[model samples]
Target: MRKEFDLQLDSFMLHCDAKHLSKKTLKSYDQTLRLFAKYLDVELGITDASKVKSSHIRLYIRYLRARGKYTVASSDKGLKVNYPDRREDYKKDISDTTIANYTRNIKVFFNFLKGEREIKENPMDTIEKIKPKRRQKQLLTPDELKLLFHSFDLTKFHEYRTWLQCRLILDSGIRAGECCGLKPEDIDFRSKSILVRDTKNGKERYVFFGHKMSTDLRRWLQYKDRFSDSPYIFPTVRGTQLEVNNFKLSVRNAGKSVGLEVFPHLLRNNFAKYYLIEGNGDFVTLSRLLGHSSVEVTQKAYLDFTDKEIGKKYQRHSPLNNLNI
Candidate 1:
């Protein structure tokens, strides 16, 4: 027999599916709801959403903070063999950001239940919002950037493709998934722009590239044609679309080779930082190019520039420096 909580979760997931939410979003909702349901069942012997209260949710939040990652298995199938060499530090407390995400997901689930009139009272109605502490953004120096780029062995086909993909993200500020979804037809050489179809918010937008990137892209296309006729601009050895995680791992390994920590998103972040600080670009245009829903979202992510970065930007835009006395 199915539990009442599982039944309600299934209904909510069906609603989400009807709305055409992304797979990643659906996965998040499923994971968060299932984990909460498990906690409610085991800890409080509560198997129904209608019986849940705000106090129970608060206890769950505290429990999450005290629990360690990978210590509890969602299933017993792989409990014995998973992560045999788990380090002591791997059992550390969960971060505020992760807990905040869980809180948000739980709130959304309760809201859905309330909207559907499935529950008498919303347990999350009185729960306070979780705000994660913002960490300072780190930018790569010029020499470090150069070292990272040179770490890729461009003679190999996969490495060459990765190198060009990294350069494209640095030049265009496109997300890793967006980069992976690119096709040859998406590139407009004449306009030096790419039509990005797959985006986080399900909106399509155009992102531009520099002359140097355009030249490199053209060379890459010609070289790629000599080997594989893949549908995607960046494809696997078997001519399949490259997965985002695989690309992230490739970038991470490349950075490790050069003794630096890096990822595809870091390249995108650097692109935004450079555009605003060094290129004298405006947030409005950058936000549009980066496919941000709003300029405010873009600012919230990149506005925390360091003091030296602010001074450098001011030096370039200083009125006294530009005007002759």
Candidate 2:
């Protein structure tokens, strides 16, 4: 008797949980697999994991490409309440990037099923990986940064904390989640570096800062000590670890106030861009600092510099220009 799709999915999720994957990753896998299971049951009446075929998977991909966002809900209850503004992009097509992600999640799930001996053959093995068009990463300008930073009300504790978080990301190229996970003990004043314990890859690494950031960090620490004794370096007023979403919202609103579009990740992106283009830094050092698995990953991300940025980099390294010929 072949195992039911939902039952095998539950077992796979359990295995993933035991491996200590990040909450975001776990949620993605769960959501994608559940949706795929639902599609299989409704479209093909196939509930057994072993009965799924490559043709069924290809049909599902076509279905995904043809579908619109928010067209399907896990349950029928409160559909109107959940999506109140149906007029607002109710029929917008799902992006290629999202479809690719769903396909990847499905492939991972099928691979797990095969590995666990739940299925003799992986249905997704024959399915080609969906390649989405790479979108250019937007770099924040210096003028925009100045405006966004100044928009924050430094007198307020929450705003001050968020301002410092933004500064840390821009100065050190640390992710927003890593910034939220910081503890006072992680900071090494002597070395001007931070020990990032909670990272995307689950590996600990050191990210450095400069003298200006050092001074600001000291002042922030002194002020924070006077008010709260939260274990995290940056904490909410209730003395709890600040959530990444809250920090993201704060940064977004700050940008809105200054009439510019900004997000926490953009700050980190600017850090990498400037580190290479302006600071004349190399890929290997930046890769290690950013805690990438390898130099290739870092290069793939930061190598999409615009023509103007390339020209600026070229001018600095122009051999004849520097040789005074």
Candidate 3:
């Protein structure tokens, strides 16, 4: 009556699918569990979920740290490295953040197995969650932002669209994925807000922009109608929906032209930082605007303000500094 690890993993995946998890999330769980299964077979010659112990899970974490980017091929589950040369090129150690993610996924899987009565004792019960160190988020400076925006050639529709798109993200604090998912019907010009129907968590919310962004959107929409009658706010030249990855690449290249490192999410981060530090925005409203589950989640992500940013915020609110004493 030995329960196989692979069987348990498959059952867990089916459960995840039933819960209507995102494809990206399902794929991540699949890859992580497959790797775990490979470890169970190759390292301990233990394929049964019932036989797994907390010590084995700890050893796997250590192995992840030592192996770096190297992983055994799940097909054969052999201990040998898959691509030796490729590992040399990206020789950085496996990040604690990645390990923590893997640990979380594994815990979820074990919890599922226990609920299904597949495992009597969940080995991951005692395994503590890995708390990754939060690195200070780097944002684009005013000069860099100016340079990046100016680098775009307005003559080209694609560049014009990209510029507008970047500005929209910075102004609205919307996720890039949600931005790409926007449609013509989503814009509420009267309210100066967008109806993000395809949000990350599947909940609809409104994200607002100022007069400047609204003006730009109107102009872009008028220009866009001349060439293509696509439903999407930002569409490919062929009038198809613009892919998120391609948009990200365009953002990256634009930053490179200005001799600055940037990405789509950086713009969103800048939105949060600017809203909080400069606009004197509160966390509860900011959290809802960012479409996070709660204000606490928003606070955790953005609480790490640099000393300079803190000093600027303090100057605005300091009683002795603000009021003549």
Best by lDDT: 1
Question: lDDT tens digits, residues 1-325, model 1?
Answer: 9999999999999999898776678888998888899899999999999899999999999999888775665556546656622644466887889889988888889889988988767788798888888877789999999999999889999999999999999999999989998999999999999999877777789999999999999999998888889999999888899988789989999999989989999999999999999899999999998988899999999989999999999999789999997
Best by TM-score: 1
The residue pairs that clash in candidate 3, if any, are none
What are the runs in model 1 whose C-alpha is more than 4 Å off? 76-89
lDDT of 2 by residue, 1-325 (tens): 5448878888989999898887778888987887888888898998877898999989998998787877875556646557624645576888889999998998888889888887888888888888888777787888888988899889999999999999999999999999998999999999999999988877889999999999999999999999998999999998899989789989988998888878998899899999999999999999988889999999998899999899999999999989967
Q: How much is 54 displaced in model 2, in angstroms?
A: 2.4
- The Cα RMSD in angstroms, rounded to one decimal, for candidate 1 relative to the true structure is 2.3
- How far residue 70's Cα lies from its native spot in candidate 1, in Å, is 3.2
Ranking of models by lDDT: 1, 2, 3
Could you tell which candidate, 1 or 3, scores higher by TM-score? 1
Residue range with the least summed lDDT across 10 consecutive positions in model 3: 76-85
Scored against the true structure, residue 315 in model 3 reaches a CA lDDT of: 93
| Candidate 2 least-lDDT 10 residues | 78-87
Full ranking by TM-score: 1, 2, 3
